[model samples]
Target: MAQHWIATRPGDLEVFSFEPYDAPAPRSGEVTIEVRAAGMNPADAKHVARGRDEDFPRPIGYEVAGVVTAVGPDTEIGSGTVTVGDEVLAFRISGGWASEVTVAASAVFAKPASLSFAEAANLLLAATTAAEMLHVTGVGEGDTILVHGASGAVGVSVLQQAAMLGARAIGTASGSSFGVVERFGGTPVAYGDGLEQRVRDAAPDGVVAALDCVGTDEAVDVSLATVADRSRIVTIAAPDRAKDEGFIAIAGALPESQAYRDSVRADLVRLAGEGRLVVPVARTFALADAVEATELLMGAHPGGKLALEP
Candidate 1:
């Protein structure tokens, strides 16, 4: 028997329960893992917070890193062939808050030797989202962009990935989180009154795009005022604003976005493997402390990503 977390009913963290579970043999194209680390993100909780009655018994984690324990016959992992005992990471997996999981082989990739299990577990969701933002905005060499919530995980990824594309980022961050923005090669600006002016001053050459991780109206308004091309503006947080204003909004759940994210996972892993991309993990909690860790993640910035060490 293995242990895993689940939401017995739709609600908040109180509904989460850790229970004994039996992982079954993998079907074709499926693989089972002895989970080492499980990534924690806002969506893990938000997706189950409120939904239809039928969505109950939802799993609590989205990504994880582990050793491959079993594979369906003749299965090929996403990056290539995988064997038992292989160290790997998987994304878009259900019931990841467990000691073992059975997930589609296509979602698994070789874990980089350079990244700790915790870092690899925390990698894809935020990194792939950032990659999609940069792609849709047409960001490239010599481009300058504005990023909202730049200290957050997605925003931090945006800062680093933007730099890789030979683009410059002018990021909005709290006074305390300014270091994170600067460390990732972004120019940090306080996100409050006069934000538009602050961004302009930081990027005198001009901001060709704006990516919003923070959904505040201020973020939307400032982005609207700063970027000349509305089509170059994108938001992961403000879907209503995207519909109302006609820019762009994307989520991992959407088919197009999911395709884009899935396509880029291997490249992102390769980058991390080479130590070119970094996952800023702030803390790792024991499996039993997941609820407390999640409470903190939902509150003030923990300064970086959080993970569950199973």
Candidate 2:
């Protein structure tokens, strides 16, 4: 038996309950894992807070690192990519908060030996979001970009990936987190009342694109003032403002984003394995302590990733 978090209806983290489960035998092309660590993202809590379909008791997590325990019978042998006993990381897998999960073989990747289970579990979604944002904005060598909330998870990934692409990145952070942004190879600018002017001062050459991880009116206003092309501004945080605000928004709700994520999944895996990509785990809690971990994640910025160890 395994235990996992689930919500019967949307409300708050309090709506989630731990329930025991048994993994049914996987069908062909599926693999089952003994989840070692699960990564927590705002999306996990947001789904419950915003509500979902009438489906009761839906699983609550999205990514995890674990060891393979079973492989389903399949003529194609998709499980050949991994086998029983191999350590792995799986992303975008629904219900990943469980102590055990069965996922499509294609979604699992080899975990890098250099990274701990906590680090490997947190790498996918943020890094992939960063990659897709760069692609949609056409950011590349010689380009300069501004990243709103650059000290946050997605913002940190954006700064590092932008550097990997040979682009200059200017990151917005609280005065306290400026060092975090600078260490990731981004020019650090404090965000507040004069955010636009701060960004302008940081990038006198001008930024060609902007990625907004903070959905404030201030972030939108500044990006619009600096980047001539609205299409070059993308937000993973504020989807509601994207259409009316004339900026691009990529969310799981969009088909284009789903396809984009699928295409670039392998790249994120490779980057983490090569050590160019890093995920900083601020703290880890026992699986039973999910509520406390989640409260912290949903509250103020924690300076690093929060995860659950099963």
- Which candidate number has the best TM-score? 1
Minimum summed lDDT over a 10-residue window in model 2 is located at 74-83
| RMSD of candidates 1 onward, in order | 0.8, 1.4
What lDDT score belongs to each candidate, Candidate 1 first?
0.93, 0.87
Can you tell me which runs of candidate 2 are displaced by over 4 Å? 75-80
Q: 211-243, model 2: which lDDT tens digit per residue?
A: 998888889889999999998999988777888
Q: List the residue pairs that clash in candidate 2.
A: none
Q: CA shift at 153, candidate 2, in angstroms?
A: 0.5
lDDT of 1 by residue, 177-269 (tens): 999999999999999888988898888878999999988999999999988899999999999999999999999889999999999999999
Local distance difference test, candidate 2: 0.87
Q: List the residue pairs that clash in candidate 1.
A: none
What's the TM for model 2?
A: 0.97
